[model samples]
Target: MRAADPALDSLQGLALGDAFGDRWFSVPIDELSDALAVRTLRPAPWPWTDDTAMALVLVRHLITWGEVRQDALAGDFAAEYGREYHRDYGPAMHRVLRGIGSGGDWRAITSSQFEGHGSYGNGAAMRVAPLGAWFADDLDETVRQAELQALTTHFHPEAVAGAVAVALAAALAVRTRGRRAPGRAELLTEIAGRLPDSEVRSGLRIAARMPDRTSVRHAAAVLGSGLLISAPDTVPFALWSAAGHLDSLPEAIWHTVAGGGDTDTTCAIAAGVVAARTGLADVPPAWLAAREELPDWVAEVSTSS
Candidate 1:
């Protein structure tokens, strides 16, 4: 039973965050802090990066299959990368995607990353919010689908845990929208309780305990804002920021950006979760106009194979 297309809303939010965050990378080192301090908005043509690109592929996959079909997903990931390798994908991905695109077994190729430890990179978590929204009504299935999709590229337990956490956050955000927002501590606990015991889960637990009034800089320093580009170093802070600003789309992105490291992915995670609840209803028209247009193929995409 399909419902309203909140996942599309999540995708848009993810893209906006991706593009907005990417712009910060261009700022002069000294100017970056001043820019962030002023809350100045990036101008038009905010082109998104790999986070949005991979997310689009995931959304298209869900529209075609309604759930993860791992082999096909692995192929789709490769195909998408093949078409557009300029989306600022992480270096590891270029290697991984090239291997998969060359007809190598995805499991073998992916499991072989990071010297056979597999990748615990934040890539799995960065692009999974829409999938979470897609199965928002049933959290068990949300975790199930999230894990499957993540396994296509990131085979490490921590990476899988990161994906599950973000997906759960997006699901809860959508489920609670237009209703009383859940307690931040309570919400983070619920998400943490559902995931395996890993640093990501541990960080989420810590995020649950932090005072909501904490500064983004402090929170990022503690929970991390993707500085390491690994799940343990990222997802906790993204979820924390999202939990704190579920009601405001723009503020959530801004706050997430203040954390600095891996700004694009952190902002993407937080924005996607917040927008799953708030939609673009509260987002300024100017901000929307500034974001580069989403792919044309996204409009009215039918949820059928």
Candidate 2:
């Protein structure tokens, strides 16, 4: 189990998860509609969705700044986002970005969301795996930087919790790649210690108890899937998938998408963390070919960084 380059591994994982999860929408109706019943992927080109796009934004920020600069990242997010205009942007996030586009203060826009609690959406969790991989050698710093990045728009506790879980998961995966991968107990303990008290933490505690469920179908039932799309609901499913399939990026992502809720994000989180440790060697070549092409800036940033 030789470790791969963290950046390359993380990038591939994020891309694969994004592309695989995007199958629900990009695939033919017959294929997607039948995926749940079959529990098998059709041989098709995977086209990633918003999850990959936002992730590229974060990777670009890290490559350019070396650390997350709140203002700069926020501006980059606003610019890169809203381009599709039809992608599934959360209502609160959409409002925040719209405000930024209209010359409103980023802080003001974020602060005004969710009745001043700010957004607790899984948006932060969706894109944070790369940050964790970037700081894998330093778990504490991984949590710190994840917080700095998440606060750009997601100021709520659950959002922060979700980001923390993803960051710590990425760090654990990278740190343990060459050795035995962390088991569910160790993984959860590390993440729980880094995170403060929250429902997300509680859900993780629950996830650690169900490691052998070995199926996203069962895990999501216990973990609430991502239909709620909050940190508690979404993060647990990702953690469960990551823990159960720690060494297999494709299987982890498959489990996530199989959960049937917030497929892109759950898969993104699972892919990002697992891939950081396992690398792209395990990803199907066809899936990579099918994914949306990375932006030139995103590529330049990851490579240069």
Model 2 misses residue 239 by how many Å? Answer: 1.1
Top candidate, metric lDDT: 1
Off by over 4 Å in 2: 1-5, 25-39, 297-305
lDDT of 2 by residue, 1-305 (tens): 11224855686688788777766634553555477666676457667766777777887677667788999988888887768645677787788877887777888788778788888889888888888888888878889999998888787888998998998898888888788887877788678777889988988888887747456667778887678878788998887788777888877877677777777778888999889888878777767777777768655544554
The sequence of per-residue lDDT tens digits that candidate 1 reaches over residues 1-305 is: 24537898899899988888887754554576688789888767788899999999999898888889999999999999999899998989999999999999999999999889999999999999999999999999999999999999999999999999999999999999789888889889999999988999999999999986888888889988887899999999998988888889999998888888898899899998888888888888887888888887776552421
Q: Each prediction's TM-score against the native?
A: 0.96, 0.90
Error of 2 at 66 (Å): 0.5
Model 1 regions more than 4 Å off:
1-4, 26-30, 302-305
